[model samples]
Target chain A: MARQVAQRDDLLPVLAETFREHGYEGASLSLIATATGLGKGSLYHFFPGGKAEMVEAVLAEIEAWFEARVFAPLRQDDDPAAAIAQMFGTVTDYFRSGRRVCLVGALSLSDARDRFGQALRRYFALWVEALTEALTRVGHPPEGATALSEDIVGGIQGAVVLARALDRPETFERILVCLRERARAA
Target chain B: MARQVAQRDDLLPVLAETFREHGYEGASLSLIATATGLGKGSLYHFFPGGKAEMVEAVLAEIEAWFEARVFAPLRQDDDPAAAIAQMFGTVTDYFRSGRRVCLVGALSLSDARDRFGQALRRYFALWVEALTEALTRVGHPPEGATALSEDIVGGIQGAVVLARALDRPETFERILVCLRERARAA
Candidate 1:
């Protein structure tokens, strides 16, 4: 019984990685089964609604992770600079310094956005809003804070795309450094 | 006949749009046929190598357009600032002020990158290289030029993702305005 629960919990990361690497449309049931080391019956037992349920659970886990580790700190931390700095570090580690794709960002670019629009929208929106608040606390005017927040958030997403396109993880790291400098100077 | 040639040329944009809206893996031949108003037999006649051939043709057309309009201008234009400004204008128009997805950028984030790695890499690498050259002419040191080039290019791609994710095209346009301001300052 305990093993069953652990197996279900462990399946989320594998599913996330499968979607990240293969994308929603590209990650077929056979592929998911292969990645999770589960048969179709086991998968359906765990996720009756199938792939959509699997993706929903993955998105939920991702959102919960960011909210606890990243967003809440940006909004609630006493030190805005520290919060922003931590965001950079956490983000770097989260994306594996560019070796990993942003599953949410990748989904946003694909037609899967249509299937998960609200969750996708909320993820990025909460991020920008939280960072904008942090930037405002950092002494920028409201308008500048908002614009800069968008740039920083959008810039990170773009850097991921460029890094993957170039097959160069260092590109992602370099851009993060530059963005860090800009955020610090701000 | 001339009509057939024109149909082939016109088919490129439709195929690009289809792929842009529905990713490479999601875009089936039936979808392509519906988008291009061409039957499978005729599509095969034009692209004997199948969907791969069609995508290759689209990539070639996109590369050619950027070469003539964006990249060549960045590389050869006498006025660096003017060239940069013109690039902003052309890119905005090319992306339809954030309403259009960058097909290459989208593909880079998908599993399709594995299949079209060379063309995908060349498309972005050239854009960054040409932009870096233009930024160098604007007086930035080589390293700074390259970093800024990546930031600008990546930022644009990210903005598209954000715009689509948030269902707000203005987010994209707003980011572009900020990027343009940064480029001018550089």
Candidate 2:
């Protein structure tokens, strides 16, 4: 049972990538099974609730990632600049240098919008709050920090879209630089 | 004959919305045909090369929009800020306050990345160049302006992604504010 649990954890990342590449509506069960090297029966065994449950798990995983790689560092750090820079590094790494499309962008606009909408909103809200705290520590006033942090969250997402479309990492990199610039400004 | 041409022109907006909502790969011919209220035969009749040609026409329509609304005004006006603000107004109206998804974002990471890459790149490049020129005229150094303009394009695209996912217009509105800030900074 432990071994099976371990294998299922391994499959989650694969499934995440598959969903990222193809939105929930587009990522058929057959495609998920093929990508994970698991037959439909095996996939069902791992995700008994099927695709919807699998998607919720993936979103949960992403939220956990932000907690570990982003908010944790920001909350624990004294240097907001370093914290923000490290967060961007984490972001750049996660998106695979802009090659992997953001599932949030796709699924939010997909037919599942109503179902996944609140979770998506929560994801952005959490990121903005963490970043806002960091910005506030860097001497920005409360209002400006909140607002700027919101822009940063949206801006990073926007950069990912552009970088993906242009098939380049420069835009993503430049935006990261802008994020780092905020830290330097302090 | 003229009536048919006019009817096809009317279909462009509907097709554009469908493509914008569902990326190239996801926007199946049947969905598009249904959206346009046309049968497959009629869709093919309008677009002989089918979806690819339809996408090309949509991109072309976007290009014409830039010429009339963005490029034409920037080229004609001396005040870069006014020109840019007007352009943002046009964009705000077009994207329906950030409810619409961008096709470039959908297609770039799509399977048709290779087939439609050039046109997508051109779409961004032209927008960047136009903004760069406007910035240059307002005293932004040429090199810095080009880079910033590119960032703006990517940033706006990213903001749209966030706004769509969160189902909020504020993020999109904020990014446009940032764009306006740059214009004013010059």
Candidate 3:
């Protein structure tokens, strides 16, 4: 029983990695089973709804990880300028850690448009809202702050897409530098 | 012979629509065949390299269409601010025209990352270069203009994803308003 629990615990990261590499439609149950070294039956035992359940678990794991590593730091830093810079660094690290595209962004493109996409949209809105509030507290007007917040978030995502295509992290960094400067100026 | 040539000319828009709606990976040759009312053998005959060639043709066609309808206006108005607004309008129209995501952005997410991805990257760089040069000419420093240019482009792409998810085009308009205001301030 202990071994089974450990195996289940181990499956999340592997599944996240698989989803990152292959996307939702491309990542198959058999592929996840093989990667986790669990038989199909064991895989079914852990995720009865199959791929959908596995993806939900993956989304939860990623959301928690992002909240701790990315969003949490923003709350800790009171200086909006510094917080913005830290946010960029956190995203850079997250992307570099696994050389993965943003899972939420990737899932948004799926034809299924499952609950996974909804969860991702919610996470994005939360991040934008948090950033908007931070900028407002820093004295920028609400309109400007909200707009800038959205632009910065959007730019980071675009940079991620470019970074993946170019196989270089610097593309992401260069765009982030631009956004940081804008935030500081504000 | 004239009737056959006319038929081939009529097929391009349908083929382009298929590529736009389903994307490269999600779009199958069989579907294209059905959409175009061309048999599989006919499609193969016209596009010997199969889906890749067909997709390339579609992308090229769309690029030309954008240049004629979208980028052409930028050249018409030498006033940088006017040109930028016009550019935004063009982009808004393009997105609204078919509720389509940028094909380049969509293809970048797929496993078929080769020449197609490279082509998309080049097109994006071209856009940035044009916008940055215009901004620089309008008195903004090279660095600031380039950074802002990237932010605007990236923001628009991200907004498309949001718009699709929410089933609302207004999300795109909000992002556009922000981008235009940022440009004016810069």
Candidate 4:
């Protein structure tokens, strides 16, 4: 049975899951309605701009979550190593240890990128930036830190792809461990 | 007008691009017909099993191309370092320096993965395996070689995602250079 959503914000996670499961193009309004237990009328009332608006709200929520939980900590926390460690843990939990898809990354690969390109770009760019700051704080040189941050961020995205493709969550876990070690040694 | 395709094999690339542009679910029959300049009847004549068959044929073509161009050289070439270098070159060209999406990687992230999971798994597993062999031959220890192969393969896939997300082909190009160097150092 579909669960009731009490508020507009309550729909964000459900919408995000729908997008992750079926992708932006595949997630039909009907599928979303089915997922959220909301009729088309109610859905329209919540998101007058339709699926695009719903996705936008979802992306905003995701960005906000990352900012508070991952990015801000990476940038503002005094313990650089601990902050990086926390970032990895938060990411692991967020991605459900590779069982969940990165909706932004998935959309970036699909035609929806043409429409939501800016949001997608910002999601990744901010991640790389925040991580670069964290790495630099850990005493790595700026250029090397930037490159390593990109590698770690991109590596996480790719590990999710591979783990899902190979149906092996261990693959994701193993890569995360390696990445964590590399960051520590950096 | 769509270019004439005299052979069944000729349709593979068009199908691949259609899937890349629109994704598996988004690439409907009409869109494919429009892309190929073929009517419904002709498309059916060529792919009696419909879109699924067409996708299967495309995947097969991709696997064959990689096997001959990338995997075979990595596994069989006497100069492992050169083979690894050639793999990077082939991959960069194949992805069109990040302008082109990795269709297999994209599929692995979408709902289509439920249907094409095995093929997706084999595609990546084989690449990692072949590259591991090349790295080992290049003098890296067996365990390290395998892990490094995973990192490099996953890095490429992630780089593609990041490059497209940011609309910066240079992101992909830079990562490829880094991965190439990493492989050489390994």
Candidate 5:
């Protein structure tokens, strides 16, 4: 039998998915290893800090994704509205049309909250900061822009819960539409 | 020494808090027992089905809370807006001003989702249904009312996440206001 070595980058999304599907505490290392078709030892090789490190890596990856797809486009010199529209489409696809839940939200619970609280807080803060900047660029008042930015991110998280609960993909879509309306409100 | 016997009703909230503070997987019998100042054996006496039963009990309690405060009031003929407003106030207090996370959202992840998925989904659906009925009475279109109600519930869940992550109680308050606006929309 040939042994396959997994790269660190390849393991992050798998770990994120595991965390999303199972709350952070529920997703055991063995479960993650099984998901990736890798051994627990191999997972350790990639994440030296164990589950904690794996969580940080997954969160960082998610942040990077948002930065590239959503925040960056919002700052482009082209039509801000157009950029936001495209970003919304990508968000829908990334969340699998809102069928998937947020790993960040799941991991933020319980002991995981104590372990990853600062990073989680920073992640949300950065989102609000990034979105606020973009909204300001589009002529929204700073205070309202900041508030709306927070609401948009928070609202999307809520949409994930509702989507799953109701078994409706359209609920997630409606949230994005509401977000777009706020972005364009200014 | 006087022994304090905890009632089943008292134990439910403590267990709910344990689950909230720690994900369901992490909130062991020992921890839950400690929270209520009861022995592990005593916990079992109250919850014969073990962790699963405890979860069912907690969920049942939450449902009862909503039935009494939100749904029932919505169905009342006199001023649904007034009832909803009162319900919102109770909800605000129930969440401790957003300093708390949703046990439903936490438990709905991974395996617990499989165990309690239907219950969780039904809980959310029931909220949407009740809100839709009230909104229609207040003159909102049925479809729009349904969609908005889902958003309001989902948005609150997400807001809980954001508030925890951001360490901002105001974030939760802001979400309530957004919900209020949607509720009042005709």
Candidate 6:
């Protein structure tokens, strides 16, 4: 039982990578099994709920990483501009490290209109709310700051899409820089 | 043959709707066949290359529609703010038509890294260039205008995702209003 648990733990990262690469529908159980060196039956043994459970686990892992590496740093500061710039760095690090599509964006592409969708929605809202609170702390009106936060987050997400499409990180960096400057100006 | 051609023409919109609703990976041949009232064999009959070809056709159809509805209006006059606002209105109409995800956004979410990526890049470049040219035509510096255009486009795409997730059009409208105001202030 302990060995089985260890094996499942080892499988999670590989499964996350596969899901990130091909998305939910495109990533097959066969691919996950192959990547993890597990048979289909073993994969089922680990995740009885199958692909959905695997994806949910992957999302939770990514979300935790995002919170620790990205959101936590931003929430530590009160300077809105600095916090905004830090968030951009987090985004850059995320894409560079994972070479993966944003999980939220990926799930949004599916007919996932279920708990997965709700989780993604809540995740984004939390990010926006965190940024908005920081901005409000820095003296920007709550409404404008929230709007700005939304734009900044949105711009980064869109820029990632463009960057991946063009195979150019510079595009993403340029957009982030643009948003940072705009935030500072505001 | 003429009847077959007409039937094929009628089929494109149905296929496009399926792709738009469920995305590329989530959109299966079976679902598309059901939606279009065609059997699997009949779908294969029309689309010899199957799902990929059907997706390619949908992309083409969407590209044409986008160019007409979104891009064409921007070229009507050189007033940057007016053109940008009008472009936002086009996006509003496009999203409000009950299509939850933009084709470009949806394509980016899929493993479209090679196949449809360049086209998506070109479409975005065209959008940014149009806005940049308009802004530059109206006296903003080329660099600043280009960055602003990126923010506006990115914000709109992000706003759409948020709006769809929340099931509210107002979220998108609010973001667009902020974008327009930022453009005017710039």
Give a tens-digit lDDT track for model 5, residues A108-175: 64568778888788777877787777788778887788778887888887777677766679878988
Model 2: DockQ vs. true structure: 0.56
lDDT winner between candidates 5 and 6: 5
Colliding pairs, model 6: none
Q: What is the C-alpha DockQ of each candidate? A: 0.85, 0.56, 0.40, 0.88, 0.69, 0.57
Query: A1-186, model 3: which lDDT tens digit per residue?
Result: 335554565789999888777766677778887888787889888889898988888888887887776666555566766776778778778777214677777666556454566777777776777777767767778768867777677667777766665555666677777777766644
- The window of 10 residues in a row where model 2 chain B has the poorest summed lDDT is B1-10
lDDT of each: 0.89, 0.76, 0.70, 0.91, 0.79, 0.72
Instruction: Locate the minimum summed-lDDT window of 10 residues in model 6 chain B.
Output: B1-10
Tens digits of per-residue lDDT for model 1, A1-186: 223444777899999999999999999999999998788989998899999999999999999999999999999899988999999999998998766889998888888888999999999999999999988888878878888888899999998899989999999999898887777634
Arranged by DockQ with the best first, the candidates are 4, 1, 5, 6, 2, 3
**For candidate 4, lDDT tens digit of each residue in A87-136?**
99998998987889999999999999999989999999999999999889
Residue B67 alpha-carbon offset, candidate 4, angstroms: 0.2
**Model 5, runs deviating above 4 Å:** A1-3, B1-4
Clashing pairs in 1: none
Better of 4 and 5 by TM-score: 4
lDDT of 2 by residue, B1-186 (tens): 222433677888888888777766668988997898788877888889998999899988887878788986766687877887787788877777678766666566555567888888777777877888887877788879877787677767767767877777977887778767766555
Model 6 lDDT tens row, A40-135:
878888889999998887777777877776666566664655776677777788777224577777676567645588778767777877777766
Backbone clashes for every candidate come to 0, 1, 0, 0, 2, 0
Give a tens-digit lDDT track for model 5, residues B1-186.
566666889888888888888767888888887888888777788888999999999999988888888888887648988877886788788887778777877665445877888788878888878878888888888768877777678778888888887778988898788778878956
Name the TM-score of chain A in model 4. 0.96
Residue pairs in clash, model 3: none
Instruction: State every prediction's TM-score relative to the real structure.
Output: 0.95, 0.90, 0.84, 0.97, 0.93, 0.88
Model 4 residue A152 CA deviation (Å) reads 0.7
Error of 5 at B69 (Å): 1.3
Order of all candidates by lDDT, from best down to worst? 4, 1, 5, 2, 6, 3
Error of 4 at B186 (Å): 4.4
TM-score of chain A of each: 0.94, 0.91, 0.87, 0.96, 0.89, 0.85
